[model samples]
Target: MKDLLNRRRLWVGGKGGVGKTSIAAALAVLAARRGKRVLVASTDPAHSLGDVFASELDDTPRRLLPGLDAMEIDPEREVEAHLSRVTAQMRRYAAPAMMDELERQMRLSRQSPGTQEAALLERLSRLMVDDDLPYDLVLFDTAPTGHTLRLLSLPEAMAAWTDGLLAHSRKSERLGKVLAHLTPGSRRDLASPFEEEGGDANHDPRTRDIAETLLARRRLFHQARRRIQDPEHNGFLFVLTPERLPILETARAVSSLEDAAIPVAATLVNRVLPEEADGAFLASRRAQEQSYLSRIDETFAHLPRPRVPWLPTDIQGVDALERLASCLEQAGL
Candidate 1:
């Protein structure tokens, strides 16, 4: 278990409303208790880390407990930020009318399906790879199965996009230098955000270098794509309630993860009724749970299946979160 713990990037996912956030939070707290620096991030667009921690989290990472830090990545914010940086360079190159249309197009691009989520994952990979923010373990509270599957496969789309963008940038650099003479501002070439502003917006050395570097970052995305595809470094933890629909959805998600070559580390069955019973009401509930429990065992016979009992209340406060973590220990996950 220690060996598995040391070499895994655990990603908790499943159907929506199946307690993936709860399981991810518990696991994050458990790793922290074991004396590892852990970061629990929310990639779900709905953003529940704040609700789970009983505190607000912005784009910046915040310390949640003694050893655990948490953050909720708002996909829209990431996409807007990325577009703003890139468009500043684009404006320096294109004509006034063309720049206006491009800006409009970029805004529409944000509204495009999957763009925000993909950008969020790319940003998460960057944080994980940064030496300065090194962590012993990183837990991702992923979106529901459909969205999460798309996010996991985002690397392929991003790689393709990078290839096309790089080609466009090369052409833009040449055209931008030529167009600088046609503009009212007598500039040598369009400068990048990194370049100092001269009378000619095109003449900024920082802008030119930024354009070159942005194109080069294609290599970084490629490296991230390769890393995400590796099983040893990435683990998918499927969370579900012991119910029919959730169970079926989990099966579909597991199949998709396998298709994408992402590893399934374990299965977490949450809000399970305890096996013990006293009266008719309690006994019938346990019996129903037992039926589904049997199905889960049969379904995931090859993998470790950990069960977490239903708490009397929502696992919101730190004490409740810790109690949930204790259940993980009891199940020997």
Candidate 2:
């Protein structure tokens, strides 16, 4: 876990309601205290980073402490922005006759499945590939295990999708050239499907734009994917409690990430009962927790597993998060 701090990016994920946000916040604070400028962004739509920091947060980064910054991405806004950008670009190159239909399709596509995720991934890719980011480290407080896994897997999927689009565009360009040579008439007869009539069929700007856009998106996805899979540059931390369902789900999540070539840096077991706690109910719960703790050790023995004792009260505000950071430091994380 200590080595994980050396990485430039960290992604924290786990079962919902497992304090993943709190753990991510603690890590951000810890890194900031260590003199690293850290930006912790919440990718979960049901964001609680603002609640944890006791401050209002939005899409823009907000300073939470001297060197710590936080933000909660608004997925709906990202989707709208993404569609708007696409619409604007298409309007510039699309045939005038297609404008009404294109606008209608774009509006309808906003509610399509995976549209929100695609928009979110575009935002994430921009953040990861931005060379001028001010922060030294970026921590992602991700959604629950399944959603985060899908999010992390998106670059590859999108790259494949973009590759297909580029291939088809290139094929269309070749077909247009062949048609222009075979047919003797105005260039309008040989215009590619994407181009306006009477335009240069051999070098259609619209086809070039489509190909360029897809290729550029593919390049960005590749860049982000490389950075995410590089162990020296990125860390994936799984936060879970010592319980049956969370433990099982985390194991599966770790397996899925590893299969995607993304390394799981460490496992954090939160809300463990303290040994000093007394009472029949508490003692029994501790015994149950011990069993699950042993299972966690056995399941993830190859990775660092840091256990955080259950706090007497809910952790909120900077001070409590700082205390949790201290606990993490003491555990050598």
Candidate 3:
């Protein structure tokens, strides 16, 4: 359980409306208060960290506690930014005649199903590899289980896609090279993106922009996947309550992560009933929860299961978070 305090990265996720945000916030508060520089970020499109912290938050990291910062990763903004970058990159190679079609294609890509997730994955990869990042620990408040599973599976899929493109490009280049011996201007030299832009566009007619872009992206996804699978540095923490649906969903999610070789650190069972509660109605709910708690123990017997007592009021602001943090610390996590 103490391993939670030292991980370089922790991704908190589970079924929606499970109070995962609050749990993530509490962990951040605990870590930051103990002198660890922490960044608690929300990757879900519906922003609620601001509400939990009782402070306004945006894309930028805003200082919360002395050692803690918070931000919301906006998928919409990332998608638009990704589109703009690609548009600009394509503009460098596109001829005047193709500009209208290029614009139409880019516009249509905005409404595509996987565009949002792809854009978000790029942002996440950048964050994961950022050399200038200052936080000792980063906690990601992720979306619901299904969306998160898809997001986690993307790096491999994208890398494979890039590999196919590279293979096709190589085949085309070989053919082009063979034709170049028989005809003038039949092939171009591949230019590295790091090289300074200068001279005529025809300087190296073989400038393989497709090859360079695809290769670079493949490396990025590969690096992202490596870090994501490292158990020593990363933890995939699932937050759930003592209930039937969350338990079943978590079981499936854990199995999926195991299949993907992602680390499942532990489960934080929030809103466990307290012993001091009175009344038959409350007792009945507690009895049912007891059975579910037993089920949770049996299900996740291999991992640490920390139970957090239910609060009379909703957890909010630094004060409420501090209280929750204390409970979390006492839970030995």
Indicate whether candidate 1 or candidate 3 has the larger TM-score.
Answer: 3
Estimate, for each residue in 1-333, the C-alpha lDDT of model 1 and write its tens digit: 333355447788888888889888888888889998988888888999789879889777799898889998888888988888778877765788797789889989988977787678768778646656668888888888898777767667767776686567556755665566567876543533322334343344644565465555555666665666677777778989999998899988888877877678888899887655378998888888889999999988877887888877888967888998888888786
How many backbone collisions does model 3 have?
3
RMSD to native, candidate 2? 3.0
Q: Candidate 3's C-alpha lDDT?
A: 0.87
For model 1, where is the 10-residue window of minimal lDDT? 192-201
What lDDT does the true structure give each of the candidates? 0.77, 0.89, 0.87
Q: Tens digits of per-residue lDDT for model 3 on 1-333?
A: 987869889999999999999999999999998999999999998879999999999999999999999999999899889889889988887899999999999999999999999889988888887757999999999999999999999888888888787677666645554554556653334332222345332233344666676778778878888888999999999999999999999999999998889999999999998899989999999999999999999999988899999988899899999999999999998
Better of 1 and 2 by TM-score: 2
lDDT of 2 by residue, 1-333 (tens): 577788888999999999999999999999999999999999999999999999999999998899889999999999999888889989997799999999999989989988988889888988988869998999999999999888888887898888887778777677766676668674754556445545453366777777777888888888988888899888899999999999999999999889889989999999988878999999888888889999999999999998888888788999999999998898788
Query: What TM-score number comes out for model 2?
Result: 0.92
Root mean square deviation (Cα) for candidate 3: 4.5
Alpha carbon deviation, residue 117, candidate 3 (Å)? 0.8
Q: Which parts of model 1 are misplaced by more than 4 Å?
A: 1-4, 164-218
Query: Quick one: best lDDT, which candidate?
Result: 2
- Please give the ranking of all candidate structures by lDDT, highest first, separated by commas: 2, 3, 1
